[model samples]
Target: MFKKLDFFLFGWIINWMYPEYYRPKYGYQRYYILFFHYLIPQKLFRLNPKVRWPVHFTSKVLAAENIKKGILCDPGDNNNNYIQANNGIIFGSNIELGPGVSIISSNHKGNNLREHTKGKPITIGNNVWIGANSTVLPEVSIGNNVIIGANSLVSKNIPSNSVAVGNPCRVIKPKEDYSEDLSVIIFNKKIVEKFDVFLNSNV
Candidate 1:
């Protein structure tokens, strides 16, 4: 039929255009493959063929929303694992998540067997490096430029520019003060003098 042909053509076009984004080397490519193979076929048979492609495309867009908002940090470098992130998570830029890192943003109350749902947002700061197999609990905000050791359980907020380690993750030391603009400290008198106007304005 004409409808079946149209769905096949559209799915093929999507695969060609976004080969890397949908089929990254690190992950299993399960979602991308499923959308085209199983989901599309079922929809075409039962529902309108034209609707199948659009619905699959919308799911991809939702996944991207999670990444851009910093709720789920996937730098295209971490190993693939079954990771789930809900809405309201905020992540900073340049965050590196190692393999098997799980961030849980929702939890239930202890006394209620009926699962009292609580909405907690997880925020990861910029330039953060989370080690492999680490679990970040709900309602936690990790400050910028932090380094978390491997296999650690983060249950609390970590201050900026510190190294945190252990099961319940504790800050080992306070981060040293450094210039954010210039990587190296501006100790040179001439450089400071050259930018005196800019520094004065900032102060």
Candidate 2:
């Protein structure tokens, strides 16, 4: 009975302390509220990784210093989700990480598990959506407005404005190619005229 009472009190305190958390409109934001808020044993147990406001994590994370703002991650199993950042990692704004996704920034050298191989920083650009069950390997930089399909393995750097999929994660289509059908504009006449001019200029 005391444990349940304690849990409620903890929730009340977090809700009272961070009132802005009430404004999130996404379904997954509930998961963020539940996990991050509850993960805190007390209001004073602060650590590194220096997470900015509005970021959410549904699983355990290592090397919190490497994480940036606007990252949403959910490790499906929660037990096996391992985020490794031996080098460094930079996440841009509005980046959504699907369930069971692993972003590894370093790898072990040869058969030895003690020594790690040299690797570059993993930089994920803004508006990138990594699908479920995907693994982003070391030294990879994903560009902006990219979508990686489910169960894909990102071994190489992915370019901006592309949809990549499969085991090796190949770009099947560019973002511009998918927008050819959007010919109509519903805006002010002046803005629409300017937009038309811009489109013609590109052509």
Candidate 3:
């Protein structure tokens, strides 16, 4: 088909252009073989196909029709993270998802295995950053410019420009109050910044 040809041609062009930059540790090949092979072909050629490409080939995204642009779904420390959107999930541009983040749009209605499950749509706005090990339940609409802390569970809708944390995921404060180091700086900064902020605010 024309789609297949298109994919192959694109892959070939990529292979021809950058043959030496393949990485094996994170799983990439020099010949663009892995790119075309591991790609979810159906997801790649979906409606408005030219929008974006997933960062990792190992990531599993269900119901691509429900997804939108500029999503960064990365693997966890354990590797192999999942994003499942059964009913409907719409994502705006430039949303960054850290490792071990799970966004589930459908859940079981009852204990019965055979019974039909219930689902609701999840819409995440642009410039939102979800931290590692966070789980987003169904029917949750996360607004734009939001930052979710690591190991948090989001059960309800979060308004734009907020910082939410904890098990039930309450809004801690407005995002403007949060330090840029806390929101954007990921590694080896959590403990020191929190302590520093506590000290400064208390003083």
Candidate 4:
């Protein structure tokens, strides 16, 4: 009806307004929300001042201004993800947050229902992957090259090169081949090589 026509018009407008969205193969870049049922509403959320990076339409990032995230990351890619960084949060590059993951940086005070307790910022290092349905509590520091398994609850600090899982999220194994500099270089090289391949398939 009118809604379909409205989106059609908006899509055309977007194509015209933002030439930077154009690609050689795809023509004009269109995000998942554009074709999906959730359209303009999610677009508005992405433009909000509280949003630090692209978030899934169903995800919510409260107090995102308090978070310092490096490189590109979509916190809630699949859905139902929430990042509450009221206290503050620092994230290094190449961080992946699976669906239903929650990173909470503040907690409600016991004495006062409305008031929140001050906590240290959650500091996450590079190349960390927090699995689906995982919950990272306030003031937890996870070092580089860490993988928090699915449905895990991170309550304390997790050191580098660790693979952890459980209700209390403990490290079960240490990664043998993990280098911070190599990780960053590999990611960057992959991105660069991908674009090069797109431009020159023979190359």
Candidate 5:
């Protein structure tokens, strides 16, 4: 009974504080855990969060208030993510950022090294998967259904339905069609099959 009451209370508070646009695709229990692990340290102790979404404990998100995210999409959910949304960053649905990913929207001024220039806002489209240790510089717009490979530097705009990689990050090949079905992930493995299939059940 107490467990049920606790879940219900936290669920209500979450729904009140965050609207649908600010929430992840996971359930209430995951949100509660993230609150204790990530949000508490970020908001109360460190005073670093401006959005109420679930961020990993090791991630560093700056100027989160300047970011606008879509439903079921969060950029800094992965480990060791450095998201500097000082100018602005808009994210579409189902964004997957790998470890050590840096999405910086502000650039240092050339005249004054200490000052930052307000560049264009970085906009990421739906179903995009940026690989590990990738750095997306300012004023870049990535289209939908794109995959950026590991250790790439994205300084130019990438169109939809393309697979790009490298230091300067160019479109190497076209991407295939993608499914929007729900998927499940397991620990120490990269599993992204359908959620029902993982549960041995029917959709």
Candidate 6:
């Protein structure tokens, strides 16, 4: 009961203090709402049907018509006004999207920046792990079990079971099943040699 009051008070104070800032910027408002929604206990706000938290929309979040469940969005992930056709975004169970991730589903037609034309939709496969601050452009299909490294800008399609990284990301390694644990799969001789002290401790 007291916690609910605190949540409302905090939101009210933010609204009161920054009316101009919060009114126009939907992104900021969404962040504020989501912060309180998840941070506070679900019991208090669950009763209020009117308090629908906003999903931080970026230049990439086409229409919200096709968004699915089991998506863990970091505070920095922004989906623009990308159209969600037939529920384009199909995330698998246990997908973690890090901060500053941008999943763009549509683009403009003309070269002129002022025009309002639409482009293609983005399709992300199941069990895909997108790292922090990644940008996924339109008309691209990322295959299942793909791991995209942090800060990568994906402009094309990525094959299944691959590791892609860097600016305008390129495939670093093909999909392969290893019998060893995750630590062995990711770290090679270089890492093991350099961090022998820490690795030995874990072992």
Estimate the TM-score of every prediction. 0.52, 0.62, 0.58, 0.69, 0.77, 0.50
Question: Which sections of candidate 6 miss by over 4 Å?
Answer: 1-62, 69-88, 111-116, 175-203
Pairs with steric clashes in candidate 5? none
RMSD of 6: 13.8
List all candidate RMSDs to the true structure: 13.1, 10.0, 12.5, 8.0, 7.3, 13.8
The digit string of per-residue lDDT tens for model 2 on 1-203 reads 54445445554554454332222222233433444553352233542223323222344456656654332222222333456777888775446677778889888888898988876789887567888889999999999779999999999999999999999999999875323222332211123232344333322
Candidate 4 global Cα RMSD? 8.0
Which candidate model has the greater lDDT, 5 or 6?
Answer: 5
Cand. 5 Cα-lDDT: 0.74
Let me know the TM-score candidate 4 reaches against the reference structure: 0.69
Ranking by TM-score: 5, 4, 2, 3, 1, 6
Clashing pairs in 1: 70-90, 70-91
Which regions of candidate 3 are displaced past 4 Å?
1-52, 55-57, 70-79, 114-116, 177-203
lDDT of each: 0.54, 0.59, 0.57, 0.66, 0.74, 0.50
Candidate number of the best lDDT: 5
Per-residue lDDT of 5-48 in model 5, one digit per residue for the tens?
55465655555444422332334235476567766766677734
Which digits, one per residue and each the tens of the lDDT, describe model 1 over residues 172-198?
Answer: 987653334422223212232433443
Query: Candidate 2 — worst ten consecutive residues by lDDT sum?
Result: 181-190
Which residue ranges in model 1 land beyond 4 Å of their true spot? Answer: 1-77, 109-116, 176-203
The segments of candidate 2 whose C-alpha lies over 4 angstroms from its true place after superposition are: 1-28, 31-58, 70-80, 176-203
Worst 10 residues of 4 by lDDT: 20-29
The positional error of residue 105 in candidate 1, measured at the CA in angstroms, is 0.3
